[model samples]
Target: MSQIASTDWYRAGAHGIDIRVRLTPKGGRDALDGIVALADGTSVLAARVRSAPEKGAANAALEKLVAGALGVARATVAVASGHKARLKTVHVDGDARELSGALTALAESIGTRPN
Candidate 1:
């Protein structure tokens, strides 16, 4: 992983950023809680959405939540993998450095407390 808290879960890519997120479905509201370190030594960003994990609704909600928080267009964010799993890889199309910095700040404020 990248070591930089944000880069640990996300990386700069050709299109923009590849983000690893642990999502909480049907959570009361959409929010980014913080980060979490798994027992296997993997770090993932914690986030929650109100939508249930059915028919891709939760995935859609998660993308929207991330896009809104990052000030990017909703169409720019998409779940790249792990559609049926809690851990998902999302691709955000835009400025990787800018997004990485913003996410780093957010991780610092929230810390790795899990959801």
Candidate 2:
């Protein structure tokens, strides 16, 4: 795992953390691709889901994927914002530092650390 900063994708809050994700619907698989920088220089976690972007299917899949990645219960993860957009903010209910560490490890395992 390279030395990538977790601040690029997640931020610790009072209860847990908020994660910024750029989701790709109908991506043929559910997976986290790593971190990426948008044109505005804001970084986001790149994720893909096999479900189509219809009637919140993609959003549900994203929540499941994130919960699984962070080793949390599905009920603990929710799409806090961006219900109809490609980019979304997810809120996880847990220890902020623990969740952040899990996300950092997951990103490193995916080998998509930002340069």
Candidate 3:
């Protein structure tokens, strides 16, 4: 629904993320990739999914991917928005700072450098 050039997400706690996401399905993988955009017009971790968007396959894949990236249990990540749309919301259940560092590290790994 909206366009964000980029964003830097930091996990402060289980609910560190106070942002929005515009998910993009990169079908053809078991992993999830999409843009997590914030109000400041920042985004990062453009996730890519190997699974096709069907029967929650994409959703599951997204959860796994994000959880793995965040180093938290898949159960920790919950879809907070966009069930039937390309966009979705995932909430973390932990410390805000941890999530932030994790996100920053992930961004660095992918050379995305979210800011």
Candidate 4:
């Protein structure tokens, strides 16, 4: 994985970390697109899910995808904010450093950069 400076998409918290995600529902397949910077200069982890954004299906899929990417249990991941919006804040319970490293690796594996 390519090395980069500390990312803004996630922040280490007392319990674990809070990740900023920009989601694309019904995106054909479930995958992490990469890191992206918004117009306001806030970075987010771009993700897509096959599920439609109805009755929280897309939110559930995003939680699962994040848990899998961070090598944590599904129960440990939750959508902390933006229940009905494209951008969301997800909270994961685990070691912050380890999760951050895993996220970095996952991002590199997808070969994506901020756009």
Give the Cα lDDT of each candidate: 0.85, 0.88, 0.61, 0.87
Candidate 4 residue lDDT tens string, 1-115: 3333447788988789899999999999999887777788787888999999999999999999988888899999999999999999999998888888887787678654756
lDDT of 3 by residue, 1-115 (tens): 4433334433244455633445556556654344445446556445667767778877777788788877888888876778777656677777777677776666555553232
lDDT tens digits by residue: candidate 1, 5-100: 556788897779988999999999999887777777788888999999999999999999888878889999999999999999999998878888
Positional deviation of residue 63's Cα in model 3 after best superposition, in angstroms:
0.4
Estimate the Cα RMSD of every predicted model relative to the unseen true structure: 2.9, 2.3, 5.1, 2.5
lDDT of 4: 0.87
Worst 10 residues of 4 by lDDT: 1-10
Query: How should the candidates be ordered by lDDT, best one leading?
Result: 2, 4, 1, 3
Candidate 3 residue spans exceeding 4 A from truth:
1-14, 18-21, 31-44, 113-115
Question: Which has the greatest lDDT?
Answer: 2
| lDDT head-to-head 2 vs 4, winner | 2
Residue 22 of model 4 has an lDDT of: 95
The superposed Cα distance between candidate 1 and the true structure at residue 75, in angstroms, equals 0.7
Question: What is candidate 2's lDDT per residue for 1-115, written digit by digit as tens?
Answer: 3444668778999899999999999999999988887778777899999999999999999999998888899999999999999989999999988887888788778755553
Two-way lDDT contest, 2 vs 3, winner: 2
Candidates in order, TM-scores: namely: 0.89, 0.91, 0.69, 0.90
Model 4, residue 111: C-alpha shift (Å): 3.6
Between candidates 1 and 2, the one scoring higher on lDDT is 2
- Candidate 2 segments whose C-alpha is farther than 4 A from its true place: 1-4, 113-115
Q: Which structure among the candidates has the greatest TM-score?
A: 2
